[model samples]
Target: MKWIPQEVETYLSAKEYVDTAVIPVYSLSFGEEMKQSAAAFEFISLLTGYLEKQFTGRILLFPPYTYLKSEHIENVVSGLSKWEETVVQNEFKHIFYITSELDLRMFENKVDGSLIWLPSLPLGNMNEPQKIEVVESQAKQLLSIFTQKWSNHE
Candidate 1:
């Protein structure tokens, strides 16, 4: 059997139904005479659906790229809030989140010890384990910075 995380395992084995969000991104604009390419849109839909099935409907948040307008970028500060509302309505404990620092403020927040940052890569072509080790070490050092603040409140 595979060693799945507690949350992921529970989500996968759950008897109740779950809700999911299908979101995607693009590398170009739609109105600049470069009409939204069918290829991009199809790729997004396919990946989002695949991820949703794999996570068993625990994922709710998605970057607004498939259909995001210019105004949506300004609303990112409240992005988590919107996700929480969706989670509440759906009553799910597992949320599979996928995004980048460009959207998640990766350098700004302290990650929970349970989390990991995975850079985009072709794992089969490189030393993926070593890369993960390096990233994990950095995560530990970064997380330590906030530990002091948290300890003081105890």
Candidate 2:
């Protein structure tokens, strides 16, 4: 389920079964690093969308948790901590934070949720079909990770 109103309504109706929340973390930047930032955004957005579709009834795909690339890592972690508290309070059993920013991995243990750091795959040159194929491939790889987390909780 996505963050859109219609999907959210569906989620509200069957909240019990939606035990996982996936939040994509994006590091935005302007000037010299703009292209890199955009690539990461596009790649992660597509990847998470694919994941949501595959696990539709079981996961809620939240909007990307975006921050400037120049921001301090401690601040970013602090912000994510707040999000973690809210999601946990709302009864989500699993929280997965997906990001292309490698620095986030260093602070993964500081946050309660699982942090999945995927190196950004440049998708700017790929055609639509190729983009889908790549995203699907990456999402397929993620299936086992998510299922493993679910099994552990169960």
Candidate 3:
């Protein structure tokens, strides 16, 4: 797909309206091995480039996060090694992302104050209350330091 900012701007300009930009969160693992897979960060440089050109002072492109994964620790580690700094330094008004159950602990050391984390809801037999509880626990841990807004979605 084309850079998200360009796509969003085209739609907005044609409609002549202003709206909050909500970039869909992607699994951060794709960043480390983009040579091996297609993911959001590969185009992040493109996004940043477009932001500089189109909305220099007005737009923010939220970075994606490592989402629900049961066995991709290696992938996550590689992604963090490769893209964490760039993502952290992105010139945007906000940094929004998703967080899965597996990496919650590791996130403590990696999180930056500007990032918004969307909690992952487990699939299958997990009930609504149970899911809420799961995210609540994670939220408490996050709230210990950061005060950014967080929303949970399945």
Off by over 4 Å in 2: none
Q: Model 3, residue 96: displacement in angstroms? A: 3.3
Compose the digit string of candidate 1's lDDT tens values, residues 28-102: 435652343443343333334444444444343245433243535435435544554565465543333333224
Residue 9 accuracy (lDDT) in model 3: 65
* Candidate 3: tens digits of C-alpha lDDT, residues 1-154: 1246876566445432322222333444345544322323333333333333443323343444444344475565555434545644442223333333334445535644233334343323566566445545654554432323322210
Instruction: Please identify which of the two predictions, 1 or 3, would achieve the higher TM-score against the true structure.
Output: 1
Tens-place lDDT per residue, model 2, 1-154, is 9999999999999999999999999999999999999999999999999999899999999999999989999999999999999999999999999999998999999998989999999999999999999998888889999999999989
Highest TM-score scorer:
2
Predictions in order: lDDT: 0.39, 0.95, 0.40
Best by lDDT: 2
How well does candidate 3 match the true structure in TM-score terms?
Answer: 0.33
| Model 1 CA deviation exceeding 4 Å by range | 1-28, 33-40, 55-69, 77-80, 99-154
